[model samples]
Target: MIQLHSGSVMLQGGVPAPIPAAGSGRDKTMAYQILRRHHRGPWEGQLHLTFDSLISHDITYVGIIQTAKASGLREFPVPYVLTNCHNSLCAVGGTINEDDHAFGLSAAVKYGGNYVPANQAVIHQYAREMMAGCGRMILGSDSHTRYGALGTMGVGEGGPEIVKQLLRNTYDIAAPQVVLVWLTGTPPHGVGPHDVAIALCGAVYGNGFAKNKILEFAGPGVAHLPMDYRIGIDVMTTETACLSSIWQTDDAVAEYLTIHGRPEAYTRLAPEEGACYDAMISIDLSRLEPMAALPFHPSEAVTLRELLHDPGDYLRQVEQRAAEQFGGKATLSLTDQVVDGKLVVQQGIIAGCAGGMYDNIAEAAAILSGGDVGCGPFSLSVYPPSIPVNLELMQNGVQQALLEAGVLFKPCFCGPCFGAGDVPANNALSVRHTTRNFPSREGSKPGDGQLSGVLLMDARSIAATARNHGVVTSAAEVDYPAPAPVRRTFDGGVYGRRVYFGYGKARPEAPLHYGPNIAEWPAIPPLGEELLLQVASVLRDPVTTTDELIPSGETSSYRSNPLKLASFALSRRDPDYVPRARATQALEEARRSGAIPPELQSVQKALSIPDMGRVQIGSVLFANKPGDGSAREQAASCQRVLGGCANLCYEFATKRYRSNCVNWGMLPFTLAEGTDFPGCPGDFLYVPQVREKVTRGDEEFPALLLTDSGIHALTLYLKNTTAEERELLLTGCLMNHYAAQNAAENRR
Candidate 1:
């Protein structure tokens, strides 16, 4: 269904053709055109960009605003939207979730920002309806912040990046390569956008064909997709590990903006002739089949027909993979879900940004028009992306039809996508149309000896599975008439009536409301001359996601409080991580108090360090490739809160994760290619004159790996760090750097 071309390509006569050169035509691409408009610094090789707008949900906004406040933020420099979708549940922590909602509202009022109330709209949906504009760039604190289908380029990063935007600072990065996702042919009847997206992710994610590249969608197939169909596919681009995505805009896009009462936001955006792309992905949409991603990752894609053909084998693979992931802490039995040679799932969910769009829901309603989900353990639930979308479904009779078909309709929330709602029973399987099916997404604590699994499918296939009482049937096997396209109505009144719009009306005298659960960040010391790091956790997994570094479910409720949240760091993957890190932190505390602990005295004696005051003791984590999922800053911040000073990995799965580590003042260290990291917990890594090397912009560092066996030579790399990043490391973190700048300005 998808083909990847590694070499350069160019737009020749409105089609991708192999190009001999790759440099000059890059400026002609739609992505670079938008980048050129937003770029603030000199375009030597790196890009320093300032976005038109910024967005965050409750789980992230509190910490972002807090960081900005500590850095002497007076007012928001750009339009900021705060939505309470992820922490809207209020069931996990008593009064804490609601307190965060109150805090979000108060912050919006105090800082001249916009606030969308709980259950009103999810983050991306509100952005699509209100914030997206042609040629505009938006930065968000959520990883799935993609608006490319709307002719807007949306980039998702950690909260610190949003704080930078709030402080009027630029987002710094090397100019990323652009990949052309040239689509051809229309999709088949049963194939939905998720099918095409899953196929694309499976083809490119593993091979890194689209990694950190802006995917520019063009070609003949773009004309066939409706606005919502295009949006559904676009949001899933995050799974492919691409930096961002943009598409050629047409009348359909204009009509979407017009219907949303922002006709001025529409602008025809297309690549110029001879636009160069570093690589190209050719997707034949017509060849796509209804697909499902097995447990653990979106890249583990398989055709539903193939899965049903040999259900036992595929389910066994999932079981084995789960065993490897949990390492006997918990057991997942998907093979038991097979009955009579057919796979059976207990629950089905069509929710969140990818699956909650109008087109996916209306078609799912059509598929189940005359059918009903049987009265079995199996159940189906649907969450509309926004109240406006839910209103359209009600007006179109889609909601009522699905309601009568035994499909439960839920309010707008992102809980299902991140494991806060409709959690499956232990050992049960759930088929979902959400953005991810990662291990932690199942909402079960494997450390507690409880585990469940999720399989990602398109909404159409999920509806078909619901109709068959969760027999894991593909939509292609069921003959259903397509739903007639209805006129989309965006009721701006829903937002106007409830959402707090305070942009450009800063109330500087207003007080920020703080609850008991809310707390300030602790003081962080600056980098020392010498660094002593103890390996706290060693992960051999091919890729370690942010969810495993810091889990999502109940722990997310404590994101506003760093220490409480840090307690749950690596709780799911390694329950001993927090205690080990805390023990190391105690040693650091002793070092800060002008005394070296007996544990580190041996290292000081071996290294012949005369002055213990020049050394800093902290913890380190080693993984093959870490930071694969989520843009939550807590992944790195939680580690920092528990005295983590560095991360040793072969490579980072995404740029956002590496940025998070640097912004939080953790040394983002990488091993050379094919280098084996045999270090484990209790091992020591001693680096001399670390502060001088980081300030000098040195790329390589010689270190001693002090294992019980003896000292061994090791080399670590700190590559591609900008000057500002170096300052952040020297000052301890972004907050410290900003505070120092403000103090210097005061002195001046």
Candidate 2:
């Protein structure tokens, strides 16, 4: 269904070929055209970009505003939209969730930004409806912040990146290669966007075919896809590890913008003839089957037909993976879910940015029109992307149809996507049309012996599964009448009335509301001449997700409080990590007070440094490849808050996660390929003149690893760091770096 080409190719008459060009035609691509418009730096190896607008959800907006506030932010320079969707349910953490909401509103007012109230709309949905425009660039704090279907380029990064934009700083990056996602043939009936997306993910994710590249979608298949269909595929591109995505626009895109009451946002976008791409991904949409990404990850996809053909074989793999991921802390019994050679799921959800679009829900409602969900453990739920979309569904009777079919309606929230709502019972399997199916993302606590698994599917197949009473039926096999098309209308007033539109109208005198749980970041010391990194946690996992670094779900409520949230860092992955890091922190505290602990006296003697005052002691974690999944800054910030000094990894799973570590002043250290990190808890690495070497732009550092066995020499790499990043590391972090600059300006 998907073909990947690694070699550079040029587009000739809307088709890609290996035609050689005298010079690179990358600048002619639609991605570069939009990127050049937003580029603040000259065309070179690096791009310094400033976005047109910014967005964040409640889970991240609090910490972003706090970081920006600490950096002397007076007003938002761009249209900053703070949407309270992630914490809308407020089912956890008592008043803390609501307190964060109030703080978001107050911050919006104080900083002259827009605020979408709880249940009004999810973050990306609001951006799609009101913010996305042709040739515009948006930076959001959510990983799935993609609006390429509407001709806009969206990049999702950690909250620190958003804070940089809020402070009018450039988002610096090495120039990215653009990949052509050429589409052809129409999608088969009952095959939805998630199928194409899941297949695309499976083809590219494992091979790194699209890693850190911009996916420029074009070709004949573009015309066949509706706005939402393109969006559904574009949003899931994050799973492919791509930096961002953009698509060629057509009248359908123009009509979509017009429906959203923004006709001016429409503009034709296409790759110029002879435009070159670093790689190409050709997808035959007609060949797609109803797909499902099994437990744990979105890349673990298989056709429902194949899964059901041998349910036992497929389900046994999931059970084995669950056992491995949770380390027997919780038991996952998926093989038992197979009844009479058919897999049975307990729940179905069609929600979030990737799934909760008008067309997806409407099609699902049509499939379940006259069929009942049945009074069994199996249930179905639908969440509209926004109030406007919900109103349109009600006006068109789609909502009533789903209700009559026994499908429960949910608020316009993103809880299901991130494990805050619609969590299944232990051992229950759920098929969802959500952004991800990462383990524990469905609100299962393996540490507490509660586990559930989610299978990512399109709304159509999920509806068909619901219709069959959760027998895991594919929509393609079910003969259902197609729903008639309705003219989609948008009620802009729904947002105008409920959302706080305070952009460009800052009230500096307004009091900033602060909940008790909200706390400012603690003081972090600057990099010393010498460094002492104690290995606090060692993870042998091939890739450590951000969810494991700092869990989502209930822990989201404590985001505003750095220390409180830090307590949950590595809680799920390494339950003993917090205490180990705390112990290392205590050692640092003692050293800062001019008393070197006896535990490190031997190491101090080994380094032959009489004075340990120049050495700064902090904890470090070693992982094979860390920072996958969410773009939440907490993944890195939580480590920094707990006195983390550096991350030793073979590589990072995504660019955003590396940026998070740099922004939080963590030394993004890498080892030589095939280098084994045998260091464990209580072992230490000492680097002399570390601050000097880093500021001097040295890519490699020499350090001595001290273990009970003996002393070993090691080489650590810190590559591709910008000058600002070096300064941040020197001064501790972004906030400290900004504060120092502000102080210097005041003195001047």
Candidate 3:
């Protein structure tokens, strides 16, 4: 069991005394300790951080670079890598796949960044291998850009955040309320990193206990777990919706960096005495067991033993709960899996960055060393996180063992994690050890006639299920080796052989290649004095994903093509969204140019207000909780593309989504928790100088009800807008800010 030490104290004498743990009345919790290490001045009660570096995978790179280009970014100041993994099949949207790669190369050369071609490695795997170092921060366009296990305070922010970094703007936010993840005990036999993360998510998600807080993982458990194990647990913290996470470094972290050939980057981080924490969460690793997030979300969990005792009852409850998630559009039946009074799963996969690590897969291999997967529809697939991880697993005989067991091993690719590959047949059930199992993330089309589903289990449970020929089983029933005979070493030169790394060559004259599909962002006007918007799309789901904003599979090709991709905004939910939004855009253009459209004018005349007041028109999205998964910037940019002005929300699912709204020049406004946003379709709500307020760091702004009720005021909080954020708002977007800056530089 993991051993956690609570005796640790502030190591340095000069750091400010740590703030007390919230609700505990105690001053020295783990959160306060780590916060002291990264502590700088309040910088005016809000801090704007310009990421020293940034990253993105195939799923997101094209979109980020395209946004940068549209914003008039001349060159990338910090390092960025574009990996081609999600669009590996080359099946979707014709040449859109290859064209993205070509665009990546040309853009990388033009911007002086790094480019890793498709199939070379998955994004996080490559990032862990090449990007992370102690005390450094990395911003990735992908949601799971977490590398805190490596002592790098890596954050997965939306593409707009990436654009800001490329444009040399800061990540502006209120100093997050820090939370101490105090851990103790080792995970019991058969328990895995997924188990720990799932448990933590369940504990803190429902109550916003750690929402927008910096998760400082500490305690004796910090040094007890192996590096890969820590990495596994660390990546999943994104699902907890925390602002970002960092861990107190020790020898293990040092060893990880040393092995990866960047020992110099390793530095220690911890909280000072009496460090402040907004909350405290205690984790007992010894208590964690083989866990499964049944369906829909990582928080819906049950122990394998608990599920096994009454499989039918448990399965029925899960199916019933899933009905509410699909907008009640479809039925998810799991009770049918009970055959001959025993539950049998259809498939198992241990793949992607989450499960592809050597230590985890090697244990799975040992369990299935000589077992057959059987000749039924039941199937098993193992994917390595990267070429190097795959090779080491090979040399360790894990590959041969799995192959003999009838398991199919795939190359390094993020396809399984985000709907790129291994799509199951309709109505089939598959379990995976991946970062997420969001609906439609498994490459299955929910809007289609038939539907497929996925459940999350550790590599061990997946192997056990594979061993029993897909009959449900828990990893706890079996005994496996704890560690490999020897820790694997890295030999991943595949990228070195293929990718072009231009480390800081300021070649302003380099020509960029733009494909026919690649298009510039539609012109967006400065933030207006008043906003009059129609509710283009209203999502009532628990959490709205970026994928729902703009699909990923075939759309990856169009990511570089703003107008093309924007046409598909909310394509899955409201097929009519693009048309309605485009129509509104015309109305917006008329309003912006002081010319009301004939149709709108006629409608306004019928309402007795022939001349609609001069106001800027933009699309408004109403959602209970949005921005659940993926740090994709398109979630906001697409709305910006469709003439969006602001988001009215009771709350946001992740801090990054809100930041995306600000960076795209869309006002992120929060309504009273229970207040209903009054708009059916054509209703108007006005928020004024939104531009100036956002720039001037006003905590509260007067929003108005644009009706006969006249000028009733409503308050919206800017929360943590920084100076750079204000500039982005004033200039209409980050891109415009950079363009003006670049032009000014040239003029000087």
Best by TM-score: 1
Give the candidate number with the greatest lDDT.
1
Error of 1 at 132 (Å): 0.5
**TM-scores, each model vs. reference:** 0.99, 0.99, 0.90
Q: Give the poorly placed runs of model 3, Cα more than 4 Å off.
A: 1-42, 70-72, 268-276, 481-484, 590-599, 602-613, 686-723, 743-748
**Candidate 1, position 288, lDDT:** 89
Residue-pair clashes per candidate: 0, 0, 18
Which scores better on TM-score, 2 or 3?
2
lDDT for model 3: 0.74
Residue lDDT tens for model 3, 1-748:
2222222223225232233324332235343333334445564546567665788876577777777777667889888877777777666777767877787788788888888877778888888999987767788888888888887777788887887778766666665666667777888888888878877777776667767777788778777788888988888888888877878888888878787788887877655554545555778898888888876677777788887778889878877766665555556777888898777889888888788888888888877766888999899998888887877877877788889889998877777887767887876788899877777677666555445677888988888888899997888897756555787587746667888897586466877666677676777778875566666776777677767777666666667677777887877665667887877888877776777778666445433442355356787887778888888888788888888878877788888888888778887777667676554455555565555666568878766554444434567666656666677787888777777887898899
Candidate 1: residue 493 Cα off by (Å): 0.5
Question: Which pairs clash (backbone N, Cα, C closer than 3 Å) in model 1?
Answer: none
Off by over 4 Å in 1: none
lDDT for 216 (candidate 2): 90
lDDT winner between 1 and 2, please give it: 1
Query: Relative to the true structure, how large is the alpha-carbon lDDT of every model?
Result: 0.92, 0.91, 0.74
Q: How would you encode candidate 2's per-residue C-alpha lDDT over 17-38 as one tens digit per residue?
A: 9755415699999999998999
Cα distance off (Å), candidate 2, residue 22: 9.3
